[model samples]
Target: MSGSGTFAFTVHPRGRLREDLARAWRPLGLVPEAVYDAALRRLPLPPVTMATAQIGGERVGDVVLVPFGARHLLADVVGGRRRVGQAVDRAVALGADVVGLGALTATVTAGGMTLGERTDIGVTNGNAFTAAIVEDQIRLLLDRTAGGGSRPHIAIVGASGSVGSAVTRLLARDPAGARLTLIARTAPRLDALAADVADSVEVAVAHTIDAVADADLVVLLTASADTLLGPQHLAPGAVVLDATQPRNTSPDLRVQRPDVLIVDGGIVSVPSLRLRGGDIGLPDGRSYACFAETAILALTGHRGHFSLGNPTLERIDEIRARARELSHLGFRAAEPTSFGAPIALESRSAVIA
Candidate 1:
């Protein structure tokens, strides 16, 4: 898997919030040139670099650094389909057997469909693999914290989004008998999603934070523009999967809730990749699920969109099988980390309680 093969490319934009807001406001008449100038004066320039990895004897590459810094830029680039096409072309030129879109890239690309149409190489959004990892993490947390006694009540925030809906459906089918809560800004959409899973579990809709007040486990996959869950909102001994890229978890939680466990959803480990950097937020040797999906597909020689749409139970199983078959060459979620601190399973109970 090492000598000149398929490369996985992860595209990342670098900048702080003020810079992003200034860029957005520049196009509008909202802010004056002086304001933009002042903001830039105070902003520290951050360089965006492409994070590449070689997996399964093949080189997996990621294309980081877009011109714009906000989610809107991400959405626009992949929204029209033409830009996603261009992005895919760039990946293929870099020797990618399959390209995986991360976060907003995947969301706006329409589940890799548009990108696939534009690129000769395979394209995948990697949601199926993400679902698998999220579920695995939830189970691990429950086992460590709850002693596997009773299924923890779980809440899927942003349940109307593509990833959130899929996660809700998957959790509903689990035999753990965990109570499930579906949260979204759109009440109707939440209700519909809940109805879809009605047969599997008792599902309810939550349009506000109060709905998730009693939740023991929370999976946040929302595309919301602002942070939804904060330290005050969560109960003690809670486990949260911050699936959103910029993150939906509040910064205050780091100092506020030492008892709750927070794990980034996309982190996974892939074989044959030697990462020199000590750790980039994730535990050492682990890659994001989106990153791993591209490598996994390259390893198994799958060159198509493996996961898309509001993922269903059936689709989840299919991806799990594919991941399992390539288990020798797959990625696992990074261990739980709190406020940028690593949490060991043995010590998790004491820290949370």
Candidate 2:
């Protein structure tokens, strides 16, 4: 544990992504801000190092927040990369041994590979740990609902993406016998992924969301700016892991469909923290798994770009092993979170009953 060096994490104004961030602005409508964001996107802006925090205790390290917003990052890729790369350079200049890319900053840059190539410090999208935790929480949900009885039909949206592909590979390796359907916009990528996991589990491919509507368990990983899955697209008692940052399931579904279990995937427990609860969209003692991944790398001294494009099954397993080790040291996954808190299991049961 010699590598307790400072690290920086890139974040953007999540925009209308979460209800907490969109509250008062929600009444004003997303268009005005989106339009303003579009205007801001045109300006050449450098990544701002917004805040610095000292994470104390056994695994002490400093964490810096680098500014980038989903709206701006998605609107202009070339400009966004320039800004993010600038942020990384700043972190490196400021003595950060590693930097973690969050939200669109992690995804749009080829999962941190291209960005890492530009920096001497370590780079990671932090998707490996994310994929592991998502898969674990999905199994826990299934155990609670399905009770290990029958094999469930699982569908993964954005199956061709890094996190989706890793989740698909992990789930396929499970002996639970769940059938998988990979959904993505590209047919060739889906076919290739399905073929890769052909020996592990029963697999199929689809280029549309409709094919996954009937699935008992759905994992949403699409990088779409807007929500994709709605109440009409899921079956009763369906469990959804909305792994996408902006959330793949529309906010309306939380009220419209109490019968469904929608978990904000990739949340993990953090021991020491000095941030307001509402600021980060997480309750006390919890953080995003991607953030935790950076902490893990910094604490464990694993350097270089990690969990980049097309992360192999072996790499995912290796990260999962590290997570297990962290769990022993008091770092672990938090309770399944939905609508900004631990999901209401009683309500879920009432709907199921």
Give each prediction's root-mean-square deviation over alpha carbons: 6.1, 3.8
Number of the predicted model whose TM-score against the real structure is largest: 2
lDDT of 1 by residue, 201-238 (tens): 97778788777778877888876445768877888777
The whole-model lDDT of each prediction reads 0.63, 0.72
Weakest lDDT window of 10 consecutive positions for candidate 1: 275-284
- TM-score for each prediction? 0.79, 0.87
Backbone clashes in model 2, listed as residue pairs: 12-68
Task: Give per-residue CA lDDT, model 2, range 1-353, as digits (tens).
Answer: 45456677777666553332342134423445555455455666555554454344442333333334566577778777777787788778777677887778877688987774654888888888888888887787677766455778889999999889888888888848788989999888889989988998999899989987789888888887777887888888888888788666776897998778887788887656544222355654677878777777777667777767767777777877776666644456677667665554442242321
lDDT (C-alpha) at residue 191 in model 1: 83
> What does the lDDT read for residue 197 in candidate 1?
86
Model 1 bad stretches (over 4 Å): 1-7, 14-49, 56-58, 74-83, 147-151, 275-284, 346-353
Q: Candidate 2, TM-score vs. the true structure?
A: 0.87
